[model samples]
Target: MDKKTHFDFVTSIGLMILSLVMIVDSYRMGVDVGGALYASPGMLPMVLALLLLLTSAMLLKRSIRNGGARQNLAGFVAWFDIFRKSRMAREMMVGALILALYTFVLAPRLPFWMSTSMFMILLMAILKATSLVKNLMITALVVGSIYGVFQMVFHVPLP
Candidate 1:
């Protein structure tokens, strides 16, 4: 087992625990006596919790069948060794940081379209999306489509 598989197992367990907590919290939120199906405050949480539970279960099963214990037995040093010179690991870390920056820093400060377009372009570049023209086209199309759906169709205000 390598870092990817080990990380998958760890993430599965963590998400399973998170979903269990969410389920409990949702139950505590209570069902409304006068509400229609899924009209209660707990409805969304319950749905998300179940989806997380189902997906994490599948991930755990797959990870266990794919030498999960070997990674566990390797210890932190061995795990660290796996990514000592890995460009992909560094890229992934940077990608995650970029995503965090987009969500927390850019999304709130900038207008929705500009922030989203910048995020899409940056992410595409990081992932090595085709030529420059193609990247811009994809980013514009995605931003336009999202803007159309939310602003025109849904008539929702964006940050």
Candidate 2:
């Protein structure tokens, strides 16, 4: 199998797994809540997960038809080497980790403004967007503006 086909095959499988997990979690959230599927909190997510599953299955079928299934274990190992060696891949992985941390960990534990400021600062520093002082100033301005708009203008309480 060629590189593109192999990559597509692996990506399709990963997406399929993710969609399945989403479906399971959504199901666990209670599809029949409020006595109707449409009224359920998980309805939209379940529908979206089903759509993702369908698309990924199609991609998997196409990749296999294009000879992606012919690849051996060594091909998979070689494909992963690009991530290990590429500087861009490392940066992208770090960025994703930071985003996941902000969404799943920090945002829930801290106030919205504090978590957002921290997230922005860390991302700007990692991306080398500017000096520390400038990064802090930008984060402060953005977070403060958002807080002001939501709290004062809209009369919404931020977590």
lDDT tens digits by residue: candidate 1, 36-140? 546678878989999999999999888888875555536434677767568999889889988998999999999988999998888888989788799999999
lDDT of 2 by residue, 1-159 (tens): 677777788888999999999999999787446567777888899999999999999988988887746563346678789767899999999999999999999999999988999999999999999999999999999999989999999999886
lDDT of 1: 0.83
- Candidate 2's TM-score reads 0.63
Q: For candidate 1, what is the TM-score?
A: 0.54
Candidate 2 at residue 105, lDDT? 98
Weakest 10 consecutive residues of candidate 1 by summed lDDT: 68-77
TM-score per model over all chains: 0.54, 0.63
lDDT at 113, model 1: 88
